[model samples]
Target chain A: MFKSSRFPIYYKGHPRMFVKDKPIFWWALKWVHARFIIRELTSVPVAFYAIILILQIRALSLGPEAYANFTNWLKTPLSLSLHVISFLFVIYHSVTWFNLAPKAIVIRIGKNRIPGLVITGLNYVAWAIFSVAIAWLFLNLDNLM
Target chain B: MKKSSEPFWWALFGAGGVISALFIPVILFIQGLAIPLGWIESPNYQHLYQLFGSPVTRLFLLALISLSLLHWAHRFRFTLYDGLQVKHLNVLIAIFCYGGAILGSLAAGYYLWLI
Candidate 1:
């Protein structure tokens, strides 16, 4: 008896079963699901940080005074808080990405596949080295100049 | 069968994920927290300007910004589709996400060139 335009053919005394859409809030109902949701949401903070960097570049293009203003803004509580939240989210993203990398990247040497732990280990090591290199560059920028 | 553009976006997402994971945290810690909080000396304007003036640095920034945005676009598109269950608006979501990333990259390029 239930007939819709999309499903016009209906048997006598038979109605199409109606299934309700899953609510978005369902993701938060379980920790595992929430973690997955959080991982996807990390993109928002990553993109936000990129936009902030773009604005910094724009400030640099303007002149020294403008750049100074921009840096000054960076010192404010609001900027610091935003950056803190973004930093945490980006770190979470990094950890999850590294953990997932082994699954995504399978290496074979003469038909012997590398262990996932080794892949994940290498990712962490590389992350540490890169982080140190960048920190060294920033801390020693004056000396380098 | 028609070619699907999914792979292209997925590739960008993967590259951006690696790049951001490697670089963004330290950069944010230094520029966003350390220098701002006086834990480290903020590089003088002249030094920072000269740093940006280098072609290598400019190229790196361009790559980082562009890839990060592309990564965001790709992931966010899926987030909208699966997370929000707005799969019906697939075409529009794809266009908006990718288009925004492209525009952001162009803007970053323009500003980097200006600098």
Candidate 2:
């Protein structure tokens, strides 16, 4: 039989271990905590972009007049400011995601593990390629069609 | 042990993170910022409609919208659970977050199909 002291089994009336919860004040004041909070907050802007795109598609479905109205709204100062803010937040998210990629992905060949910088570098390269491809497609939509 | 559904959601979060990081920036820049700000010429409605009419474009839009929303759902769920210390309401929060994402995705699909 396993010893109770060694195994630390839970039973009736067992005392639970105590752990301190992270303080809200630390989250507000520390740079590391701020980065973590900001990273999570990026989700708001991402979700916002998704909703905007959905509305855009809906407007497109409504007809040219509706779509034009949506575009005009998009051109407004308020809309422009929101896009600018969200764009900045999204860039931060992207940068943080890429920097963390090396930690998440581990590549190895034989006895050798691929360097983390190499993994991070590849992510950046892929990001650049995708961005360029999307830009090119949009910019040349008329010519391509 | 009972199977946990955590991995399923985690996989979605990871995929969404990658997609948003790589594609969303440029999409937002062009469609949301440059075109609207008059820095880049906006594509005409006819051309945009024609583009959306393609099945490939529709599929891409569906994927982008759905996954990005899912990413938000998963991330926000954790943010609420841990950051806000609302773990006691975990089930309610999970349903609310993921349900919203699914509904938004369905709306996107419906709109895309209409176009």
lDDT of 2 by residue, B79-113 (tens): 87657666778899999999999999999999999
Error of 2 at B35 (Å): 1.0
Q: By TM-score, who's the top model here? A: 1
- Fraction of true interface contacts that also occur in model 1: 0.77
Q: Write the per-residue lDDT of candidate 2 for residues A13-108, one digit (tens) a residue.
A: 545743344553456777987789889989989999999999999999999999999999999999999999999999998999999998888889
TM-score of chain A of each: 0.86, 0.83
List residue ranges in candidate 2 displaced over 4 A.
A1-16, A19-25
Instruction: Give all TM-scores, in the order shown.
Output: 0.92, 0.91
lDDT of 1 at A37: 86
Write one digit per residue (lDDT tens) for candidate 1, span A1-145. Answer: 2222333464645566553446667788899988998999999888988999899999989998999899999999999999999999999999999999998999999999999999999999999999999888877888898
Instruction: After the best TM-score superposition of candidate 1, give how far the Cα of residue A57 lies from its true spot, in angstroms.
Output: 1.1
- The candidate maximizing DockQ is 1
Instruction: Give per-residue lDDT, candidate 2, residue B112.
Output: 96
Q: Score the docking of each candidate (DockQ).
A: 0.70, 0.61
User: In model 1, which runs have C-alpha deviations exceeding 4 angstroms?
Assistant: A1-20
